[model samples]
Target: MRQALVVRGGWDGHQPVEATDLFLPFLKDHDFEVRVTDSPSVYADPAVMGGVDLILQCMTMSTITAEEVAGLVAAVEAGTGLAGWHGGICDAYRASADYLQLVGGQFAAHASRYAPGERSGEQADNYVPHRIEITAGDHEITRGIADFELETEQYWVLTDDYNEVLATTTTATRSWGAWQRPVTCPAVWTRQWGAGRVFVATPGHRVEVLQDLNVRTIVERGLLWAAR
Candidate 1:
């Protein structure tokens, strides 16, 4: 069986442990030998990560040691798939530009308003209901998934050219704030690194939200699509 390593723990607000747990059985059922660890030791030893097929990161908004970051980059470059949600991969390792570049996007600001007709960050509500627009219909990751609605935070991310966008969400203008800009956010996206694949979803802030069928399907498909 192919191995999948999960290093989960960072900001408690993202519920890293709980969120990572949601995918353990799913991966195991798919024949991946899943190993869950707290320390980033696997990232340090290339030998440990060498034969691994996938890495699922639940760490959010945390700093990573240079060696840890390097090990992950090396592993992915060696063709191990990397995948995560929310801020785990994107907002993590704030000081490491290398990490952000490897992930293909960075979480800039949360509540700040963006410019008009530009892709800018917006204030998103967790309880707000919104629709996820399927942008790339032919992608395997979103093959069966259609436009869906859910109650989650609409992610306003600054994307890089590497992302093969599969879906997006329309940014609504808020009169409560003084921003006069219309922005569209990427809700789900996939990117390639070396021979490996990376997939990200921005809606999974709360554990309960991941229980939604649409959300679960998107993430579920992402896991399989991202795996080597």
Candidate 2:
């Protein structure tokens, strides 16, 4: 059986614990023995991550020690799969340049507005009807998932050139703001790091958002596809 370590708890707004809970059963269903921890123990012990097959991290906007970052990068380079959604993986450790490099993208901010008067400067609680266009239809992560609409926050990312973009969405148009030159952004992508895999989706802002059938299916498929 494959082993997976889930380290959660950084920002409650992303519902790290709750969002992780939604996906835990799926990993187990695939015959992975999942272990959930909060102390960052796996970071300290190289042996603890030695045989782990996958890592489902839900931590957001926090600082991870250098040792922790090295351990994670080493684990993945040694063949463990790494995957997560929203800020849990990409935007989690802002201060750690190495972490951002490994993930291939960093959450810059939530841009554009969902509707009139709905634009809050906040990344959380901003909801809108965004379409996730299937960019690379031949990729395994998005193979069967067609172009679909998601009513969630459209994330803007600062990315590296390596992502195999599978899906994207246009930035919401605003009437008040008049600086536009055709806005489009990556909503889902997969990248390879060493022998490991990294899958990212930008639509999952709230637990309720993922409840949408298409959203759930996209993320669920992403999880399985990202696993080694």
**What's each prediction's clash count?**
0, 0
CA RMSD of all predictions: 4.6, 2.3
lDDT of 2 by residue, 27-110 (tens): 899899999987555765888888888888888887888999999888888778888888888788999898888888898766
| lDDT, candidate 1, 12-103, per-residue tens | 88888988999999999999999998776679887798988988988887778899889988888878888888887777777987788788
Q: What lDDT would each prediction earn against the true structure? A: 0.80, 0.80
* Best by the TM-score measure: 2
Model 1, position 221: C-alpha lDDT score: 87
Lowest lDDT 10-residue stretch of candidate 1: 118-127
Candidate 2 regions with alpha-carbon error over 4 angstroms: 39-41, 112-125, 176-178
| Number of clashes found in candidate 1 | 0
Evaluate model 2: give its lDDT: 0.80
Error of 1 at 88 (Å): 2.0
lDDT (0-100) at residue 203 of candidate 2?
74
